[model samples]
Target: MERILFGDNQFFAVNHISDEKSRAQAIKFQNDVEIIKTLDYSIDAGVHTFMCTTHDRIATICDYIRSHPAKYEDYKIYPCMPYAHKYANAVTELGIVGTIKEYVPNNFMGSLFKGGVAIMSKDYLSIMELMIDAEMKMFRNIKTPVIFLQNVITDLLLGLGMTEVLVAFHKYIRKKYDTEAGFITMNMPKLLDLLEKAGVENPIICTSINKAGFRMSGGKELYETVLKTRKVRVIAMQVLAGGAIPPKDAIKYICSLPNIESILFGASSRGNINETVSLIHEFDKQYQYDILSNF
Candidate 1:
């Protein structure tokens, strides 16, 4: 079976011996774990500010928390979205004790979103700090804080009513590849240019990478080439090559990647959580591989 790992940053799945359904199940498990953890943290932190909405899940969470008296919160409820007033009222009747937050429709991409705003946690802060420090050392410059700051500026131009015809000069270079199938290859500079044109700031980029028919030396060279451009923020993914690595091997290999900031992992149960945590704790950064041979 493929062993999965779930953490605050991302969910990762790797299997060399499992079927696709098991992978889907692993992702679902990760989603469930995150929800459960959210509630548990709220209760543990003694923060009564529980946010919920008309999504039918509010009731279940409320009942679950209420039934466990030791874990109850002061319970200020927010409709998952502002328009869910009727559902919000029903939630209030169920004994939740707070008003809903106001909403502006145009800013929202959909009628409802996961929380209508971005949620940040300690892990996120730590990762941001790590990125900043890494960029500083890599570039040896303090004025430019993020690696992708320039592109972000270009993307913002669209907001100023500038037409693409004037800015079409930005798309200057392109490249094609004939690498193995499933090998994720991205043109770093081009991607940053695109993100800039769209007004994207320093968002962390995530994508899958495949290591097939190549040794660790080949992988290292490929990564270094991308790194030199300073345009692409690269992170390795699909390291298991679609279940190409056995579960035990997946855990060890993933834990071994030194350049990886955090592996996105997914889980389905408490057992998955425990195993993942254990692997994280067991990671040894001292292990070194030739830049191209490790992958």
Candidate 2:
């Protein structure tokens, strides 16, 4: 994972703080061209990995990246799966069978049969794999090094005590997609415990690690303790705590943490992107300096 991973929340009108800002962002990125241009800004600022949801518009971005290979030769996308709204809207418009037909891979009948059998036999693991395949279709020709389970599903599975699904997702992605599986969750401590107990070693998890503990489940102290003690690779998101903390302060707090392998954020402009990247670098250097000084 890159030290800094760009996110797609802003592109998809996902503002955690202000509804007005979300509406403005929706208007600004109404076109795929605008989204692509903003992504280019991030690339130009030295952020190469895009951590994003598999929203319908992302297919257009993937198409653009596929069309211009040379420009994005080193770019990587970490696709978070099962964009719930996409399915809900699809089901409303196309019905369940039609929704499956629209999203599933080209092996239409084969996948549908498998999905049906999985549903009938209550083999939800197979259904999960099928849904992963369906969500992954748009990212077909792109360089996706890590596939992620979104928190909407991850937390739900956690609450349901379905750690088997997590293990299944981990194994399925490595087996079928030839990529590592990542999980995004709001509750880091509980998920980590479950993953470790399930014999998943050094799992990759993306979650909220912020100064204000805005959306961080299990509180911030437990998260810090886990980071200090655990063997997991954590990608910190919501570091700004929905604009509660200043950028430099937020980055500084995150950089001070242990076992934070990556910092994920979204920005609509080059200045914001550059500032965040620069702050991460600056604080990272400072953190290393402090460690060396203690030595």
Candidate 3:
């Protein structure tokens, strides 16, 4: 994983703080060209990895990336799968059978009639694998070194005591996609406990880690303790607390922490991208200096 990961929340109008900002972003990125341009800005600012949801629009972006191989030769995308809204909207429009027919791979279509049987038999692991394969279709041939399970599913599984499904996802991605499996969750402490208990060692987790305790389940102090003690690789998201904390302060706080392997953030413009990247680098240097001084 890159030390700094560029996120897609801005491109998809996912503002955590202001509805007005979300609307504005929706308007600004209505075109794939504008989205590509902003991504170029991030690349120019030296952030190569794009950590994004597997939204419908992302397939178009993948198409564009596929078209321009030389320009994005080193660029990577961390695809967060099963974009919940996509499935919800699909169910509303297409219904269950239609949705399954549309998403399930052609080769796997032979088992379509067994869907009801699978559901009745509680073969959820098989269903989960099928869904993962379906969601991964768009990212085909893209350099997706890390595939993330979205928080919507990760947290739900945690609440359901379905640690086995989590383990299945982790193992499936490694075995099938040949990539590292990452989990995005709001409740980091609980998820880590479950993953560790399931015998998953040094798992990759992306979660909210900010100064304001914004969406940090189990509060900030617990998260701090987990970070210091846990062996997992954490990619800190929501570090700005929806723009409540100053950029420098947010980056400083994250950099001061232990086991934070990366920082994930979204920005709409080159200026914001450069500023955030610079602040991360600045604070990271300071953090290393403080560590060396203590030594």
Q: Number of the top candidate by TM-score?
A: 3
| Span of 10 residues, lowest total lDDT, candidate 2 | 117-126
Model 2, residue pairs in steric clash: none
Candidate 3 ranges with C-alpha deviation above 4 Å: 90-102, 105-111, 114-122
* Candidate 2 lDDT by residue in tens digits, 1-295: 8899999999988999999999999999999999999999999989999999988889999999999999999999999988878887899999987776677655744655767755535655665677788788889888999999999889989999998888999999999999999999999899999999999999999999999988888788999999999899999999999889999889999999989999999999999999999999999999999999998
Tens-digit lDDT string for candidate 1 (1-295): 0122122212223243465755664565355445667545433433333322223343444445546554442343211111133435655765331121221222332323344334322233332233223222321211111122222222334345443421232221001111100101233334434455655433233334333422233354555454454444344444445556544566566555443443434334455545544554554332443444667
Query: lDDT by residue for model 3 over 25-76, one digit each (tens)?
Result: 9999999999999999999999999999989899999999999999999999
- Worst ten in a row by lDDT for model 1: 174-183
Question: Native-vs-model 3 lDDT?
Answer: 0.92
Q: How many clashing pairs per prediction, in order?
A: 25, 0, 0
Worst 10 residues of 3 by lDDT: 112-121
TM-score of each: 0.35, 0.92, 0.94
In model 3, which residue pairs have backbone atoms overlapping below 3 Å? none
| Model with the higher lDDT, candidate 1 or 3 | 3
- How big is the positional error of residue 130 in model 2, measured in Å on the Cα after superposition? 2.0
- lDDT of all predictions, in order shown? 0.36, 0.91, 0.92
Off by over 4 Å in 1: 1-190, 196-203, 210-224, 227-242, 251-259, 288-295
